[model samples]
Target: MDQSFSGSIRWAGDNSKCLDVQGGSPLVGAHVGLWACRADHPNQQFAWTEGDGRIRWLTYPSLCLTAAAPGLPIQLDLCDSPTAPFDAAAHGTKAICTSEGVCMTVQDTEAALMLMMLGLGSCFLMMTPLSAFWRVTAAADAHDARLGRRLGWEQPGLMLMMLVFLAMVLMDINFCPHLGREQLQLMLMMLGVLVIVMLLMMPLMMLMMFVFHGALGVNGCG
Candidate 1:
C-alpha cells in the first residue's frame, strides 16, 4: 500500500507499476495502472480482487496473477488470448512459460526435489569421466606409459559415463518428476563417496605411475 514499495511493469514501457496506495487503505476496488502517465487509462487500470483480479488491457485476463502460495506458479488459461475471453478448458499450471507455450508443471515439493536431483546427477555423470579422461591424457602426454595405460583403462569407463550423462539429461527433461528429497540426499551421498574415492586414488595412481616409469624407463606409445 505504501508508495515506497515500487516495482517495474516489465511488459509496459512506462513506470506504471508503483503501488501508490497508502498503508491500511482498502485495496479491494482500487484501480492499478502501469504508471502515473497511464494511471487514468482504463486499459492500464486494474481492479484489485475484483473482475477476476485481472488486468483490463489488451493482454490476457489472467496475464500476471501470482499464485496463492509460494512455490506454486501461476495457473493460466492457455486458450485465453489477449483479445479473447478466458476458456477454462485450456487452463493449466506450469513452472515455466515462453512465447510459444507453457512449460510442464513441476507439481509439488517432490517434483522440485526431483528436478534438482536430476540436474546434479547429470552434472556428476558428465564431470567424472571427463576428469578421468583428462588425467589419462595428461599422463600419456607426460610419457608415463604405465600411467597412460592405467588411465587408458578409463576409456571404456568414460564412454559409459557419457552414456549415463546423456540418458540422465534426457530423462530429467522428459519425466515430469524425478527423485524426491530423500533420494536426492542419497544421490548426493553417493557422489560424495565417489569424489572421496577419486581423491584417495588419484595420488596413488600418480605415485604408481611414477614408480613404474622410474624403474622401467617405460614411455607411452612404446
Candidate 2:
C-alpha cells in the first residue's frame, strides 16, 4: 500500500457505525463488529504493519482483520489477507478494508446509464420549479377558480418527485462498495436539500395564494 492509514474502518451496510474488534481476542474466527466505538478505544483502531497484508487490531497485536471466504463473516484471526506494505510518505487511506480480490463491478453501460439518469433528473428538477412559477404567472394573467385547488395537489407531487429522484440516486450507486464518510455525508446533504425544499414548498404555495388573492380579489383557502 502507498497510503498511510490512521482512522476507523466502517462497516459496509451501516454508515453510522464502524468496525470493532470482537472480544478483544487474538483467536481465529473470533467474530467482528461486537459494538460501536467507545471514545477511541484501542480495539476499534486499525493500522498497517510494514509487511502484513491485513489490517491488524492495535489492541491485540497478533490478530488481523480477516475474512477467509466471500460471503463469510469477517473476523480476527492469524493474518491471511494479502500483505499491504507501509509507506511513510503516502497520505491517502481507504476507510473500508476488505479481504484481497474484493471489489465492486460496475459495467460500462451501467456507468453511461447513471450519467443519463443524472442528466434527466437534473432537467426534471429544473423544470419543476419553473412549472410552479408558470402556474402563478398564468393564473395572474387569466384567473381560474380551479387553479388554486389544482395547486394544492402539487405538494404530494413534489414529494413523489423527491422520493423518485432519491431512489434513482440510490439505485445508481447500488452495488458500490467501500463508500466512506464523505460519500455518506454527501448523500445526507442531498436529502437535506430535498427536505428544505419540501419545507419551503408550503410557504411558497402560501405566497402564491396571497398573490392569487391580491391579483383576482379571491377569498378563502383553495
Candidate 3:
C-alpha cells in the first residue's frame, strides 16, 4: 500500500463521528463502523494509502479496511492475503477519498447491483407469502363476523411504504460519500432477513388468530 495522508476519517455529513474498527479487534473480519470521534482511539486512526486508495489501519499496518463482498459489511483484512476475495491485487475494496480527507467511499457497480437485488428481490418474494396469508385468512370458515372478507391493500401498502422509507435513507450514500457502501449493503441484507422472518411466521400467526377467534365464537354461542 502506498502511504499517504494519515488521520481520523470523519463522516462529512456528520463530523462528530469517525470511522472506527469495531471492538478495536485485530481479527481479520472485525467490522468497521462509525463511532464518536475520539482524539486518542487507536481504532479510529486510518491512513489513505494513495495509489490503490487502500485505507490502511495505522495501528496494524498490514490490515486494510476491506469490503469483503457486495451485500456484506466492511471488515479488516490482511493487505496482501492470498484468499480469493481478500486478494489485495484485485483492488476490489479500494476506496476514493475527498481531497480534504474528510470522507471516503467505495464505488463498485457490482456492489450497487447486489444491493438492488437484495432489497427489491426480497420485497417481491415477500408478496407471495403475504398474499397467501391474506387468502387463507379470508377463506377461513369460522362463524366470526369477519369471515370471507378479502383484505384491502393496507397491509401490503404499509410494507411498501416501509421499503420506500428504507431506500430513501440508504440513498443518502449518493449525497454523502462517507455513508459507505457496507452500511447500505448491511441494511439491505437486514431488510431481506426481516421479510424472510415475517414469511416464516405467517402460518403460525394465522393459526393462532383462528384459534382465538373460534374460541370467542363458541363462548358467544353458549
Which model scores highest in lDDT?
A: 3
Off by over 4 Å in 3: 82-222
Sort by TM-score, best first. Answer: 3, 2, 1
C-alpha positional error of residue 44 in candidate 1 after TM-score superposition, expressed in Å: 84
Give the Å shift of residue 24 in candidate 1: 99
Better of 1 and 2 by TM-score: 2
Q: Could you tell me which residue pairs clash in candidate 2?
A: 53-82, 53-83, 53-84
Q: Please, what are the lDDT tens digits per residue for candidate 3 over residues 44-154?
A: 777656565566788998888665333455678886753212112211111122222211232232222111011122222223222111111011221221212222333
The best candidate in terms of TM-score: 3
Q: What does candidate 3 score in Cα RMSD to the true structure?
A: 22.6
Q: Give per-candidate clash totals.
A: 2, 3, 0
lDDT of each: 0.27, 0.40, 0.45
lDDT of 1 by residue, 1-222 (tens): 111111111111111222122121222322221123233323332222232223222233333322222233333222233421211111111011221222112223322211101112222222322111211111112232122212222323334643553454345434524445654454445445544443344454334434432422222211
lDDT of 2 by residue, 26-102 (tens): 67767665344344566566655554444566666567665444344556676544432211111121112232323
* Residue 157 displacement in candidate 3 (angstroms): 36
Which portions of model 1 miss their true places by more than 4 Å? 1-149, 152-157, 169-178, 191-222
Model 2: CA > 4 A from native = 1-3, 80-100, 103-222
